[model samples]
Target: MRLAPVSLSLVESVLAKPVLDEKGMILVGAGVKLSERMITRLKQLGVSSLYIEDKRTDDIVIVDAVSDETRRSAVNTVYNSMLSMIETERGARRASRPQIGREISRVFQDILADLKANNSGLINLASIFTVDGYLYHHSVNVAILSTALGLAKGYGQKEITEIGVGALLHDIGCTKVPQEILNKPGRYSDLEYELMKKHAEWGYEMLREQDGVSLLSAHIAYQHHERNDGSGYPRGLKGDEIHEYSKIVGMCDVYEALTSKRFHREAFLPHEALEFILGGGTALFDLSLVRLFAKNVAVYPIGMTVKLNTDETAVVVSLNPEYPQRPVVRLLTDEYGRRLDSPYDIDLTKELTMMIVSYNE
Candidate 1:
């Protein structure tokens, strides 16, 4: 399967993967042939890309670090918990429900178990969701990415849970913001930006008051925005003053947000987003954690078509666990832009001189 941008040209293509809703339910099942109407509807839903069945790359598989069941359960849990908070703030409910912290903690335990079962240890967050579900999906993606980073950093189960739970509810304070500001399609005004920055403090206060939520976890919400150079918001604590867990969650938050398509701008490819993160190392984030993230996350996901420095075109077939940035790819076209009759594979780790220059060409 190959990942292609959603357009009218894809009307006849079959879906390689299921399109999921915010609740994790399948809106369109895999192997279904797309029609003009379906494609138009998908575009309306803000689906920028789709995995299309390609005979040449049929063998290439995009594996999620966590299982479908685990991911769905996590998304549903986040959606309900956050929605409940939003309702409470609006006075639609008497008060925010109790046990939110405990509920999220339990869901995260399942996520951890799934991650441990996967031997790859590399993360590929390839799930497709609509723009409206961005908050829930973003929260879940952050938790998954944060959990993977925690494991890579040699954290124990207890420490991993703390970071994972914190990552899950990091943006819970957005529930307190007005819907108009939160859902605005364009950049915020000066005053609106100030209100937006208040989410961190609001989230920290909300989480701290919840049962089963630790003070440390609540602090993750508070300090996730704080930069290592004291350039971030809320408190702007510098260097070691920010908690280690907050730093991890904050880095993951930025990465997830960048890679996700937003109302204001197109999503950055994995490699592009990683480059931005690496460029901000030490100044905006902890250098050590940034390096760890670069090592563990897949910069080029499976099935993505990329142009090589050698002027050839190839599709990433698998990841190099130890060197995720250098994936094994299958050559699809020659340097002269002619399609190969029989494509061959190349392990980028073995061919260190060759590199991917761009993707989705």
Candidate 2:
């Protein structure tokens, strides 16, 4: 059933997932196929952007023209901001600049402030794709996620600021790796992989040369990938041998990488990524920290739809902290084929009779 063009509010209330149209309307069910026409009409109506559903009605289509002049300009601006941050940091390494560390600290502090302020303009980083501005954008995401993880653990501002600094510079070693090897679209030779591994040592040397900079922050670049079972790179330090901060950073780093698209592979869905991390456990990560992250993070965030084990479909209306993976859902229909309110909260964990089949991204 195709839908008539409706207001964004109407779409939000009725749709099972976030609709993607460039126009201000929500297309429902079979009506979703008309997204392109909806966008054209919305543009004619002076709407800036709109959301729609995937062809299968399982995921939200966030429509933003990569080629749109206005969006392109914003992409460039954000990308440049990330580049400038990384470049200044590199310059700090070469000059052994004291101010760089403080500046890094300040930037992190600003992000925390903005997060706490519940900034009206802040977009959920999870919903946005990092393809347009990979490195700089990835850095920001890591810092923000890591910082949030830190705060959730009751860290003081000083410690949180330090974690932020560590996260921002955690990939400094990547700078030393040859661009040809780093950016290779194809698989690398063993020799190339060996060269890539040296980034840890290179990053350590770069940060060590600076005065008054925290050594732990520098270590994060080298140690973030080192696993708890001694299977990772460089030193291969085993459980407890890895620093606490590095453990947290590693969890965040891997999570970000799994969810992000790379030249090698498309990003995994968040739940699938979480499953991979869970499999790693004490072998690849600290067990406790991994659980903490999984607990706090949204496995299926807002605007997602899901299939219930009861042979019914539903939308994720809210998160259930006590059961992070099994969120409260609004059932579209009961097993007997009856409709209900759009915002019902059925806790799946408690409903042992039901489980989430798959999430609608």
Query: Residue 6 lDDT in model 1?
Result: 88
Local accuracy of candidate 2 as per-residue lDDT tens digits, 75-132: 3333443345358666673556566565566556566775555422112343233232
Predicted candidate 1 versus true structure: per-residue lDDT over 1-361, tens digit per residue: 8777888988889998888888777889899999999999988888888888978888887888788888888999999998777777677544436678778999999999988888865788878888888888999999999999999889997899999999999999988888899888899999999999999999998888777778898999999999999999899899999999999999999999999888888899898899999999799999999998998888988888889998999998988878887889999899998989899999999999999998754
Question: Would you give me the overall lDDT of model 2?
Answer: 0.59
Instruction: State the displacement of the C-alpha of residue 166, model 1, in Å, after optimal TM-score superposition.
Output: 1.0
What's the count of clashing pairs in each model shown? Answer: 0, 7
Q: What is the lDDT of residue 102 in candidate 2?
A: 59
lDDT of 2 at 126: 30
Please list the C-alpha lDDT of all candidates, in the order they appear: 0.88, 0.59
Q: All candidates: CA RMSD in angstroms?
A: 1.9, 8.7
Q: Candidate 1: list runs displaced more than 4 Å.
A: 92-96, 336-338
Q: Report the poorest 10 consecutive residues by lDDT, candidate 2.
A: 62-71
TM-score of each: 0.94, 0.69
Give the clashing pairs for model 1.
Answer: none
- Position 295, candidate 1: lDDT: 87
